[model samples]
Target: MGPARVAGRRVGQFPDGSESASIYMNSGTCYDLMKNPTKAIEVYNEGISKYPTVSLLYFNKAITLFNSGNVEEAMTTTESAIRYNPYHASSHNILALSTANSNKVYSLLAGLYFLAAEPLGKRASGRLKVVEELIGSNVKKDGEKKVNISMPAGDKIANKPNDFSSVELMMSMSAALSYSDSYKDETNIEQMKRNLGSIFGVLSETTAAKGGKKAGDKKAGFGWEFYAPFFADLQKKDFLDTYCHIIYASSEDDANTQWIKDNSCLKKLTTLLK
Candidate 1:
């Protein structure tokens, strides 16, 4: 949502600047909307050249490459985005969708990444279910350990020559104070507790689950809250605010905006947050 719209923007102190801050912010979006991925990539390269720390440029460029059928390039660029900011939801989505389940770690983390994206997150629950089914069915039917999932047409994560692993990404998330550094909020602790529960809850499904811990187990492995603190503030937003943030990518105070609240899945998630 718009809440993260300004994510990659930073003030240019004249001496260290490349393009104007606003230009970097809008250029890629304009190019993409105009259906010119080449231009978007060019713009993103310019932005990254000057502001290498801006994760959004990498994210934008990754998506542009993905759209242009440059799957391998997209995967690499997505990793760069995540390296710059482990919580870049867009980059996570691109990687999850692009990376095939041939890589077990990304397969698992892809679902987690979708879930972690929160309201403004990637709507990838269906993909998770698909991955789950593929994983589950193959292990039961045959002795095959590598599960190749069938992706929806035009929605594949990536194709050809991909060995990107999420090992380092996991370490970055598990480290303490990562999210707190950005999210300074009151409900951070409570939010972390719930999120860790959900993460372990899902991970417990696989035999590869660390320490063989259950979803809600306290010792599911490492100190999850220590590494994943962004979940805290992500869960504290009101339903409508969450809705607006995700749908519009903006935090324009939508508490009073009336809308249907009949999504069954939304109900379950709300209960978890409460």
Candidate 2:
């Protein structure tokens, strides 16, 4: 059975189940997993309204909001959840993801730095640079106390952080810059290669130290597979071709020969090129 139905069954067995916020939160989770975010939000909202003091309910609602693409609302809801319960890990994780997806890249990176720094410190630099370059400002000044990066946009648009999708975008941009023939201008190519080499070198060393394969080394042996679709969609032919070569070279997969035939994304990309 689904999460909501299971939660409902569990609640039905309890004498005070009708008044339990956790049951509602669980129901919402089931709905979310079913891709019914609106229903999930409604259920979470009801739970919060019924049990105003239940911090977890607020967290659930905030996550629902985020999944529904109402990131700013999600941010506020998460703050309320934290205010009610400071020790909520899911709340922190959701907040991190929400913030990362909301275009508040700088703030999100800072939060990630604080949350994952101990275990992830060595690899954080490249991710941190992604935030700085995308946001055009450093939260950490050379000789000043670290400051909260402010979003000049109104709160509605500024509160959320960059999400996993944003990270994928960064990877795509990096791949494009690394392989684009536009950089074939002798001077430009050399500079682009150097920058890409440095970035990938750092990433490789860091992942290696952690005993993980380098970034983008998936089982399919396609580096930046997720990012490849974006570059293809954008009609970045040179980058696309180079990316395909890299993946095929790395994997020696004959399937790579029929990449456009195999991947719907690449097929759409071919249309874009035409």
Candidate 3:
């Protein structure tokens, strides 16, 4: 029988009930580190069979799948991980990266969620870039016009009721508007605040109209359930400026850095969440 199939073989190895799941996660990681992605997947699957609700197992599996270039499957598995443990920051990180190309809305939400949970470190720096890219993905500077707008095409971004299509379009428009003469003179911090404010404003409106049902309500998915609601609430409460600064805490901009020091908004944000 497979090592994972040996039920209760190493029970109580740790004081807590996490030992069995940890073993499987570690075993899978070893395989992944050895460049045996197929075997790593098998091990992760076996672990998942026994611990279907263990987010770590699902997270490890998703990592292997993502590294092996199975992005769709990786995204699916990462969603499972988030479903089981919404607070798993790394799962949100991978989900953002996996879906960034296929679905900008999901990518932006996941990336934001990850940054909220882990707003420091190398992982956060990279995630911040992804979030910025998602925000700026649909705008351009064409000749003397100085601002050109574009929207992602295809059935994936079609305008379905209760879907992120509107939010996506609004985000693109926000990006284009940021370059308009009215906004062109603002600092990057102000520009970002405006852009994200527009995006989150639409998100709040859509999520509220949907009665805040679970994710997958319409074309929305885990992002709607886990990340959107919180951000929507933040927008509603007018705390989006605090949030933007928190995620961009590493910015070297004098205004950004000064804002972080001048305000207790970061502490207030954490308190509000709790």
Candidate 4:
């Protein structure tokens, strides 16, 4: 029989609480694996109704929504998961991927949060690639002699302050600068450090300008309240280098591995995130 049937058969044997929540989550996952997203969402929602605070239920539902191509709903459900448990790494992972095209900075913020919690895993490896793409997405090379820089125009369209336009422009500029003569000799890791550091610095400054406010206007939400502060603090604490290495650790890059071995900041970062 299917996992849902198995779970149904054993339902009354276990008490209602976290363990029961896990059964729901597992049954929902079984449905998902069986290519039944509708049934999966039904099971997850039932679990959420019973254990309102279980973040995994929301996370599993978000995954189903995303894989089924209901991206907007997936984003909304992931936000709910984050609301219940801010440190849910898989929730952050889905959020990062969902927002990568629509919101660059928010994707990076969530990507970093996910990596911080789940470094040195298959998930981290995939997220690191996506984060690197976001950091470099704006810069395109036409030839050895020509480069194109693309910047998002959302802030211009909205005509608003405290938006991500500055960071987007900064990212474009930094990526363009990577092709400059002065930076041409730098290794891929070095370029990543500089470009990623530039992005983080701008976000940190934005956070400071907001004067510790939990949210900006329409553009800011969970990213402002949670991710912005976390990464901003990392930038401020001079842990950006350490962080870059940590997120890239799954790549097994010699430099990143060596840096992690030489530095004491990983423990400190873990503590801060906790």
TM-score of candidate 2 versus the correct structure, residues matched by position: 0.41
**TM-score of every candidate relative to the true structure:** 0.46, 0.41, 0.84, 0.84
Q: Which regions of candidate 3 are displaced past 4 Å? A: 1-19, 157-163, 207-219
Tally clashing residue pairs in candidate 2.
Answer: 9
Per-residue alpha-carbon lDDT of model 1 for 3-112, expressed as tens digits?
22333343333456644745665767776777877767876887788888888888878888888988878877877777677655566667766655344335445444
Candidate 3 per-residue lDDT, tens place, 1-274, comes to 5443342245325445456777778777877887888978987887797789999999999999999999989998999998888787899899988987788887888888888788878888788877887898888888877777777664664433224767888898888886678877986667778988888787666652244543335345656665677777878888878888878875656777688778986686676465
Superposed by TM-score, candidate 1 places the C-alpha of residue 83 at a distance from the truth, in angstroms, of 1.2
**Which 10 successive residues of model 2 have the least lDDT summed?**
219-228
TM-score for candidate 4: 0.84
Quantify how close model 4 is to the true structure by its C-alpha RMSD in Å.
Answer: 3.6
Clashing pairs in 4: none
**Tens digit of per-residue lDDT, candidate 4, span 194-237:** 98778777776653223343333234566666676676677787
Off by over 4 Å in 2: 1-3, 9-19, 100-274
Task: Please give the lDDT score at residue 127 for candidate 1.
Answer: 46
